[model samples]
Target: MSPSASFSDVVRDRRAVRSFLDKAVPDDVLRAVLDEAQLAPSNSNTQPWIVHIARGTARDRLSEALLRADDEERYSLDFPYDGSAYEGAYARRRQDQAKALLDALGVSRDDEAGRRLAARRNLEFFGAPQVALLCVPGFAGARITADAGMYAQTFLLSLAARGLGGVAQTTIGFYADTVREALGLPDDHKLLFSMSFGYPDKRWTAQTPRTYRASLEESVHFHE
Candidate 1:
């Protein structure tokens, strides 16, 4: 495929998959995806992404560790979500997302039990056969985080091109210290995020919700 066509197709087809099949991804395919991911640009060519791909026993161990961490209140990392700062369009968008998700899962607004059950699925890596943890060196700044985002986008797009599906999850970062300890990562490294990857389970019609994006006119400006 031509670069433009390939890029557009991947962007259009990619979804945040929550259900995965038992099928395992080949090592060669995973390596190629990582290779493409590493092509992402970075500040001063620092290229500061550290990726760890876990499968089989390692994947099970990581998931077990994450579940244990989730059970402990001390493991929670608080993120600031300023509702006041998210007024009008942004706030409505967020509400719509929640409603859509709940509707898809047959969860009522007051169904706290159902919500918790759904949240637990995140800890299970949504039954994906492969899980990739992304990290950066201890001394890296915000620029490195941006580079990591670019790398992750590349990886997700590459997976989409290969008919694989996954979700990039920052929830893994909440238990970063725990994950670092569990995975035997160096103390200086920070867990940036995790992604669950594998062939998506095609039977789940509830996964069909389409996320939206702002129009170019709303998101861009023409200086010329």
Candidate 2:
């Protein structure tokens, strides 16, 4: 398919898959996806993305370590934007998302146990067979992060094109120090995000929701 059509189809079909089947993705296919992801443009062509793909024993070990860390204590997230500064529509949207998710999981607003259970699923990688960690230079500025975002979107779309699904997890970044120590990541590299990847479990009806997008006119403007 042409790049435009392929991109459009991939974007339309892509979803944040929470459950995955036991099947393993082929190495060549994964390599192709990475190749496509690297095609993403970067400032000054710095192309600053280092991806670590874990599978089998490595994947299991990392998952175990992450779950243990999460059990011990919640990690502190580094937010680019201050949540305390958010007001009005953005805050309402955030609250609505939380409510919708909790409702979908049949968890009441007061159900601490239910919330913990849902949070725990992230540590388990939602039962995905493979996980990819994206890292960047610790000293890299916001422009590098913007480049990383493009790479991530490209990676996710590539996965979707192959009938695989995944979630971009910034939560992993919250425990970057622990994760780096456990995984033996380079001192210069900082964990930006981790992604869980695998075929979706077809049995879950909860995964069927279609996400909506804002209209072009609402999201875009022209000065002329």
Q: Where does model 2 exceed 4 Å of error? A: 1-5, 74-82, 205-208
List per-prediction Cα lDDT, in the order shown.
0.82, 0.79
* Residue 223's lDDT in candidate 2: 97
Q: Give every collision pair in model 1.
A: none
Off by over 4 Å in 1: 1-5, 76-87, 205-207
RMSD of each predicted structure: 2.7, 2.6
What TM-score does prediction 2 earn?
0.89
Candidate 2 lDDT, 8-57, residue by residue in tens: 77887688887888888887888888889889989989999888888898
